[model samples]
Target: MHTCLAFFIIGFLVSTTNGFYSSSDDVIELDSSNFDRLVMQSSDLWFVEFYAPWCGHCQNLAPEWKRVATALKGSVKIGAVDADTHKSLGQQYGISGFPTIKIFGSNKRSPTNYQGGRTADAIVEQALSQLRTIANERLGKRTGGSSGGSSSSGSGEKDTIELTDSNFDSIVIDSEDMWLVEFMAPWCGHCKNLAPEWARAATELKGKVKLGVVDATVHTQLAQRYGVQGFPTIKFFPSGRKDGQAEEYDGGRTSSDIVAWALDKFQANVPAPDVLEITNQAILDDNCAEKQLCIISFLPNILDCQSACRNEHLTMLKNFAENYKRNRWGWLWVEAFRQQKLEDSVGIGGFGYPAQVAINARKGKYVVLKGAFSQMGISSFLKELSAGRLTSPLVPLNGVAEGKLPTIIDSEPWDGQDGTLDIVEDIDLSDINLDDDDSDKMKKVINYRCPKFFQNNFTLSMQSLSVYARLFARAISSTEAEHILFNGLLRLSSSSVHATQSSNSLAITYPSTAIKHAVHLVTVSSGYSSHDNNEYECITKTKRRNSLIEQKPHPSNVYGDDAFFITKHRLGDFLGVADGVGGWREHGIDPSLFSRSLMDACKSLIDNKLIDLNPLTLKELLSKGYKQLLEDKQCIIGSSTACIVALHNEERILHTANLGDSGFVVIRKNTIVHRSQEQQHYFNSPFQLAIHPTIKDPRLIADSPDLASVTSFDVEENDFIVIATDGLWDNLPDATILEEIKQIKVS
Candidate 1:
């Protein structure tokens, strides 16, 4: 018997090295012909290794796989298939890498790829853990076999469960298993789009979780129970607690997302990270690695779990844990005060009590959870990760191609002074080119500090942020992009009269060689326009952008109503327009002051490249700015409509946030592609109805205008995004605007 056993072992080694592995009876050799028969039909859990014969990694894993198969023979099913020969089988399972291991859960349809360490021990450990979960589930099912389940049994029905008001309580409520149901209206467009995906997810998660659909229109009571406001609202009913307190699932609409969320919530049973867990080197080494993102949740305030934040912290952790079965991310929690190592690793132990940080051990990078630990915030964070929106590491000067890098030099830091000019009365204008002759000269727009009393400070101390201005000028060239033109000349009267307002408040003097004060407006002229009604037709000429300033501070300056705060703010490239409501003038209020105040608020907020840049954040930024403007002395009783356009050149995202009627447009190939919709109460009464008292008659009033129309669109290389106030949009039609654009010749 000993001799025979030795011979069998030798035979197994010989066959394994060959193309076939028939020597080992414990390891089931799978093929396209027998795959479904062995895997899909089997009741036990399966650990299938898909390997290519030519791959070196496959050869190394072969012996380890044999050991794993031998160790887990009776309780678990182990199988292997030569993926290179059975291309169809590999493609079905998405086997892009060699020696890919997959864990087939209780339901063979929903399989998870093994992202743990590539070792036999790790594989065995993960397999055993899953087996235990399956065992528990099966035991519970057997004990509760008498309980009536959904009439629409999850075993055979592969798609949506047709749920009505009559049978809703009986199956979903009485059953002790999770159910994902969609409340829908028959006529809804979004519901129609979601139908196929929902059906697919039901088929994928066949026996693991139950999926149901309700005709919300026909069943008003059921709809009201779940608070289904609109069409196709998806809600997840947690196992056993179907007291009608289902969670609303709102993230991605794909079938994969639905299935993933269900699996993450149900199958993952890992505990939240604590100081004990995070400090254990073994746990960190086992969990945190290249293929997985370790999300560390640290509660700073309380050491023990008995604190008030315990429940909230654990709930947030479980939310992250749901990602385990699908994405294989590590969800860790640590008490900040308990472990200084973990705290220092993620820069924690300040401010918020329970803080979360997502660290990518592979990339040596980490991202703090800046938003709340809620579904929307976590979803946004994960979405950004999948979309490659993580902050990129700064490249060193030497790392960049020598030819593409700009010259680096050290310069003296300028003093932080408020005054930029000596006197507000006298100024030089001869050297300041206001004509087409000096269109080729480089112009600068600088934002600086100045004393409140312009006449008091003679020699103003100011720092020149010329480096940013020069870089911005070089980036925005004539050939690549152009400042969107306005229908009328912006601030033509201001240039002619210095926009004195006749108040003699103070006539400010602008430096000849240099510009001193708030913002130095320079015009780089590319070419001329001859359209009859065109105020400023901004066209891109040679590769170099050399001309045109598009901001107008005074009301008579109708050429444009834009402000370039990007240079001074050092945030991002932004162009905005604010218009003084003409009706306010009839009420004895100088509407221009409110407009200027709004623009001033915008200037201050555009400081960081990331903040105040996103569509949602841009709306919030505008709201904050508007609120601040309302409290200002000049704008207390004044009302004005604002349209701001921020350009994220790095991300190539154009975020437009407008509170009132002032809008923008995107023209492509001589056609009006995108135009911001005018939000008017009636004919021409824009938002920002009033601040003093609610006026109802002569013009319609809306204290709030539908949450400021915020829109974001990805831009093409040379797409022109034009922003202007109602002065331009109300005056010219879209077709007329496109016609004017076609008139310009691309030189």
Candidate 2:
């Protein structure tokens, strides 16, 4: 019996030792011996799969595999390996999972994993896409589609217009379309390399902006006209401008970079949304129903405030609408009492006329404006709304929860002229005080509300008061007028107080005054949190001087191979975390050195104030930090995933930039409202900026810092932000993290 079993096992091994695939199928069966010589060294493109013979998924995918192999018979080589029989080959390629497919392009040493669908159609589509990418990379040798850079004429790049000296003015200057023109020399290698990317960008921006190219060597006149000092000189000609200097394109040369820059220009060219009056149901439906956020203001009746006052309000709204045009919010207005149902539905009357509310029409929720109605007030309100920091709950719109807008009564649009009253009786204000004493009283009121630093300078001139009266001269009651002016003064005074106190704490006298005016003008539009209130108490003279003195700060927390750093300055706190890539261990490099070096470089930037701390400048900070890492004398030779968050102290806004799998999540009221998205090229392979021994090495994955995901958010006290690496995130789910936070708070 033992002899019979041994013979049966030997027969089974002899039968299927080379794996499931055979000569009958189109699939090229591979083993440990021929992997390097056949696929690695081959010049042709290859799609290879490492599979286990006993795997059910491999068996299920066998038919589709054969179909894919048949489809790309000559174009791409399809092959398979049995990992169960050849463990060395599987270990060599780091194939931990069964039926893993990899695409071998020009860089066979670092083959990319195939992430397309399992079906033959999806595989073929992805295979062709890869082939096109490889072809585009080798486009330097090709002579078609503007790649040659020898003439203005080209095939295959229809979207990319051919611009020469003869037609440059007629097509580029005269036309209303925004044009991005590239001036290149025929023999320039950089121009050749940028050809495919330029063509791709042109194709993507087909209907939006026109992209053109000129051979600087051929069109010497046009080149000198634009002062093309270098090859591949890029110039941007904006729409509707015939004379002004063409702006130099200093942005990245990648296709995505070009598209992003063009899109920004396109959006800037778009006119602000028309501030329409909701006169009827159709108008309301057209403006509000489909919008992400609808901003509706109920101004006082024309009789209450004449054309001058109404127009002033409308102009303010228009300016805000223009500033926030990128959000694509619908801006509409309605006269109070004209749209009684709409006003009541949004609870606008309780606040008084000239009230405003931002409604999320899709969610049937609205947030009433809590700040003043002037430029400062409205600006603050909108900023708060934009930051998602408005504390007011989104009250459900009346009847909107039932999928219906409030009933609107048909009415005529406002006429440019002021409405006349039935009783045309005139009144005189001869007894009212418009003298120095009144101005002094106003100054006293402002001084009382403002801090001691601004008390001496808090003076209200009669001319300023006269201007204010002229702007707001309306046929309204004295009580209402006083209410408006008093509210504005209080708001301005409160901001001044906050700014002075904050500046004192940081020992910044000059900047505090500027911050005060800026805060009052372009307000962050949120009240002080408990944390802010506590910080204000630290504004004593001794403490201020102490804070100004240089002192070494402690480093932030670290876990395993990850390093974190936090530093505070006059602007705000800089918090950052970097996760070292462990794969460098195989190459005899310490991964922790890379991440720690990166975090330390970032801390140095913050400490030395090498980079400006702003909500939108986090990407710049990352760029500077990454550059510092590259310029380090020690020569860090590993990769890391990074996440940095900058808190603009006074504004209470969090500016963040994340690269790779390390990320941060913002929890407001115990609910995650915002989080950083992981940047990954493929599954488990994150998008990282690397420093290899050889610069621009094809074997290493080195993404640009520009590709880091940069974003900003307004934060309040009690908002917990968890910044961590993939280790913590992969091991713990969001629910578990939140629960742990709750437990920590409870304890």
Cα deviation in Å at residue 382, candidate 2?
A: 0.8
Off by over 4 Å in 2: 1-146, 149-156, 401-404, 423-747
Clash list (residue pairs), candidate 2: none
- The C-alpha TM-scores of every prediction are 0.28, 0.40
Worst 10 residues of 2 by lDDT: 520-529
Please provide, for model 1 over 544-624, each residue's C-alpha lDDT reduced to its tens digit, 9 standing for 90 to 100: 111111222233422212222223333345655566564544444434444555555666666533354566766776676
Question: Using lDDT as the measure, which candidate wins?
Answer: 2
- lDDT, residue 525, candidate 1: 12
**Model 1 regions lying over 4 Å from their true place:** 1-571, 608-612, 633-635, 693-702, 742-747
